[model samples]
Target: MTEMENKAVGYTVQQGVATITMQSAPVNALSRAVRVGLIDGIESALSDDSVSAIVITSSLALFSGGADISEFSGGDLSPNLPEVLDKIENATKPVVAVLPGPAFGGGLEVALACHHRITFAGNQVGLPEVNLGILPGAGGTQRLPRLADPATALTMIVTGKPTSVVKLPGVFDKISDKPEHLLEDTKQYLASLNAENCIKRTSDITLTMSEEVQGVFDAVTAQTKKAARGFFAPLKCIEAVKGAYTLAFEDGLKHEGKLFMECMNTPQARAQQHFFFAERAAGHVSDFDKSTPERSIEKVAVIGAGTMGGGIAMNFANAGIPVTMLELKQEALDKGLALIRKNYENSAKKGKLTQEQVETRMALLSGTTTYDDLADVDLVIEAVFEKMEVKKTVFTTLDKVCKPGAILASNTSTLDVNEIAACTSRPQDVIGLHFFSPANVMKLLEVVKAEDTSADVIKTCMKLAKRIKKVAVLVGVCFGFVGNRMIEPYGREANRLLLEGASPEQVDRVLTQFGMPMGPFTMGDMAGLDIGYYVRQSRQAFISHDPTYGAVADRLVEKDRNGLKTGRGAYLYEAGSRVPIPDPEVLEIAKQEAARLGVTQRDDISDEEILVRCLYTLINEGACILEEGIAAKSSDIDVIYVYGYGFPVYRGGPMQYADEVGLGEIVDKLSTYAERLGDYGKMWLQPSDLLIKLAQERSSFAKFKN
Candidate 1:
């Protein structure tokens, strides 16, 4: 005698089907009440003779965001999500899960319990529990391999990366184009899958390996070693997948569950999860009223047609917005426009975009050498050279030509947004929209708020960044704002370290080992050392007194070895490719520079020292940035690094990495480094007092909210 009771879960039995919906708002996070309701819902559906089949879905934008993250941090797991999902898997009635948005974490586990999964187009699904100091305890590790190949399951679970619905491969039974008609569509598909059999458990299925499975595993391992590096979850994910091949059904489930629990207690998982929420938290700012009106940004204009402007224009154009790109000369405009077409063409070649879609988007872009085209734009982003006078001139011209109520923005990486705003008649409308290099691809957008900038203007800029598929971090105005401000010292330390003992290759290798995509020398080579040389020249007076600050970078620029563009820099490149070779000349130069700087050249620089010098310095500066209010929160700084600077996702970001290293230990190391090296060396080495204070109280950056 199964009974139906309405609670956190909503259930309806109609026309031989029972639709069980997780009725939690925001993100249907699997809570205790929801788990209990789900278990009861499955039982009721299974006992009802009228309900021949059952369908499960979420009543939110997301199917399920996994388990409530807060539950694992000392909060009870509530009858436990795994226990509830087990009941669903054992249900006699055939169960189907229809996913509209993302089925993440336990959400994916719930779907895995059902015999079949039907997802809508654009849906994202993954077992991302590895990020939260836990693995998918709800049978995800055991069931994923039964549904997909071991290698595919390994990649999805271990990496904790999302799989797009368009490229889901073997994860789901079917993916429909129209999600609004998902139930009907799924029912029609289910009619085809109908048999005498009832719901079957994924654990009972035997996974067959392909002939190239070993080769596949080998390739995946090699890439994971390079990409994940110090991260443990990815390797553990591989182990879980291998379990499917070596162990029996029950044994595999036990092995998977054990590994999943081991991942839950790892420091890496905690850090990654902290970063996950930090990224979402980056959007919130104090005094930024929710009621602030967002300007309608449809037709947009970019003042410069160079690389930055071209990329910025592409972001707007890619979002289906009509963008007018302006350049001073026809030749410059043509060159920029050609690059835009080439970018689209490259994307089409990579199958990232369809040819017709590329052409359609490219057709939406227009170019001009005059300000008349700017009149119709709701927003204008000035990407001219980062000079105050040039920016002021552009703003002055824009003020006269742009229509009223239009938002004016500067894509300045470090320059003062307030100074740029000062040139305009409507200073309140001026805001900073700092996009990382390769704007169309990079996710970070530092939304700098000037003292006089209107709330609506800032809100509109943040909203616009999202519309263009960029992660916008609301920041207070500063010289370099959040990302680049902290980056200055971090980059400075890398250069200083080279002059002290480390070579270009050694420095980059050390930082790369610490999980940075590239070291300072490699980055310098990529960005062209001349830019840093020029920036140093701009700040010569401030840095000149300290020979350790700009000397090595100045020497690199003086050698006329700019970067990859010149086939030489800190490291030499083998023509046409970006791969760096350890140049003997650069090593000799580093030795000479160390001698010249009166710094000890030691061959015994431990990997630990190298990691601490590079990462801790970056984290210390992040703390300073937080204190100065340049960044709204520690999470904002984390987002700046994770997205903008290629900080490793699994280690979270610099701030989360600091928490993992134990902030007290970081303070001790910084104090030791400061004592050995002078203040110049200690500039970045000094521990953030905020970090020290937090450490003393046994707190974490994750605990500190804005």
Candidate 2:
């Protein structure tokens, strides 16, 4: 027996079979070193007379996680992935790939190049490059369609979700029943194959499209266009997959490469890639390392059985943790439990959950009207009314009933967390777990760290957020934390646009065209117009300086137009539908308000002006957030907005979008607006000091270290 081993690849020969095992730990990413080793191993096996067959597998459980993303910015390296795949495909000896775990992207491309493929029953494989704003660059787009049906291949490519090997009948020659015996099973299977079954390469397969196939392609393309919206990669993926039927193997590969490069060069690709790295970066807290101890959170309790409370309890119950919900009365408790049951029933009807799973999750939840039932709970989150006095009463009661080691949290979005903590004797155990509305669905969980919040409590909630499948961004105590704080300016500007003579539909149209899921007025209507009106009333002293602040929403609430619940708001909505219809009376109110406020109204308010005023104001607030160190980095703010507020992911959140638009140009435009509109614009549109400084230095918010 002869054995050769390098850092990334290991080769050994026994009898007539040669085995190549990728040795990179963890996911075994296809870096430059692995590519070089693969090329060498294939060449050595082909030249050796004693070796009649060769097998390629991995030392770790996973075959590979595609290419090393870190090397993408390093430009073309020697022994690139394409060259490595070509060498494997051109080998004269029979080649087989044995997958033990997931084979994704370039790893799956390499498997397609082999003469035969084998996998275990539970192993997964896919080409997920479209998620990164690029299609498979190393022959994945061309070769996968040859091995699988074009429709299935297109679906896999566009969705970027993995498929189990058991479901794919023809994709693998053999699937091992026992994953632990994969290597031994592959060797026996390779030896059993003679010349008739051994020499089938995916590249030699021909694709013939019938009329039905062409119709499927057309239908899928139209569906993708509608779902992808303004994104570019998914359509390019379809174009590349179509080349397999229309062109030869080499020409199809060339076509895929051209499309891949075109996608890579686009701004959307850069934004998506930035977001991918930014999300991972947001999880890291500089002050707390991995060694920091976290408190055990086995059982949790939610105070108040309102909408937010029920949603928060569902999150814990879904994570397999028992949850107790407390309400003031049994009627309220029963109603909240009914709403939770209805939500799960709806999901079961939609096939998102099985009846068994819904029953199991519901079994984990319990309700009580007494605060004494929360004595042994590990954590208690107060989702009571938004009023300071109401929140204080709940915390003061929780402090008296809860055990000494139990954690106390509040779900208040805009109130002072520190003041809430002051109600409890143990301020160190008090932290804010400001979950977004409909907490079980929304991904963002703003972990509010008060002035005296202990490090261990912060670490525990941050880890708990991950357990419940939410992205936790650590934010300092402030009025609205990161997302809602920045939104103050954005909402202000949307209201101001109405006073300046733009129709609600016109403003909404421009924002939706710019890639927002819905315009500000539409969002307010869905969230209820009175929510903001109540918040403004609570902060009357702070907002009293500007009489026009939230004027439109206040008027709507005064007219008893409470939104979808009341069937009227900024825009009219038919009963049982959330679609916004423009109302003449709303516009009339805007004109009357403008006349009373002594504001000048213009007939032609350009979309560009509307877009700049709203978005730039949001970015300026983000800059101030960074300057105050409320957020550790700009990417954390991006994480909150993208996951919480329906900010488009393709734009890479507001801060990353600011970097793309050039900070210098933004500062210049804010100056123009500030000078154009006098005091009101100066108060709202002035650039932050950090923003102006970065603009003068020719830098970006993305580069801001803190």
Highest TM-score against the true fold, candidate = 2
**Alpha-carbon lDDT, every model:** 0.81, 0.90
Q: For model 2, name the residue pairs that clash.
A: none
RMSD of 2: 1.7
lDDT of 1 by residue, 1-706 (tens): 2336656689888778888988887788888778888987888887788888888987777898878877767766667877787788888878888887898888898999888789888778888766665666767777887878766677887778898867665667788877787877887976765666556678678865566776777788888887767777777777777777768867877887899778877778877778878877777766468777778887999999899999999998889999999998999999999999999999999999999989889998999999977888999999998888889999999999999999999998878888888888899989899888998889999888888888888878877777899999988887778887777877877777777777777777878776788888888889999988877877777677777675776776788889899898887888889998888887677777777877777777666666667777778878877777777677778888889998887777888788787788888887887777776555557777787888888887657644
**Candidate 2 clash total?**
0
Lowest lDDT 10-residue stretch of candidate 1: 1-10
Candidate RMSDs in order: 3.2, 1.7
lDDT tens digits by residue: candidate 2, 1-706: 6777678999988888888889898788998889988988988888889998999999888999999988889865788898998899888888999888899999999898988899988889998888888999999988888878777889988878899888776788899987977778886897798977677878888887779879879988999989999788999999999889889999999999999999999878887888888888878996577788889999999998889999999999899999999998999999999999999999999999999989999999999989999999999999988899999999999999999879899998988999999988999999999999888899889999999988889999999999999989999988999999999988889999898889889989999998989999998888999999999998889889999888877999999998888999989988788888999998899989999988888997889888889889999999999999999999988889888998888888899999999999999998898888899987789989999999999999888886
Off by over 4 Å in 2: 177-184
Query: What are the runs in model 1 whose C-alpha is more than 4 Å off?
Result: 1-7, 47-52, 58-63, 98-102, 116-125, 130-134, 149-152, 158-195, 207-219, 587-608, 679-684, 688-692, 695-706
Residue 179, model 1, lDDT: 76
Residue 284 of model 2: what lDDT? 90
Q: Which clashing pairs does model 1 show?
A: 66-106, 133-264, 134-264
- TM-scores of all models? 0.91, 0.97
Compute the lDDT of residue 385 as modeled in candidate 1: 89
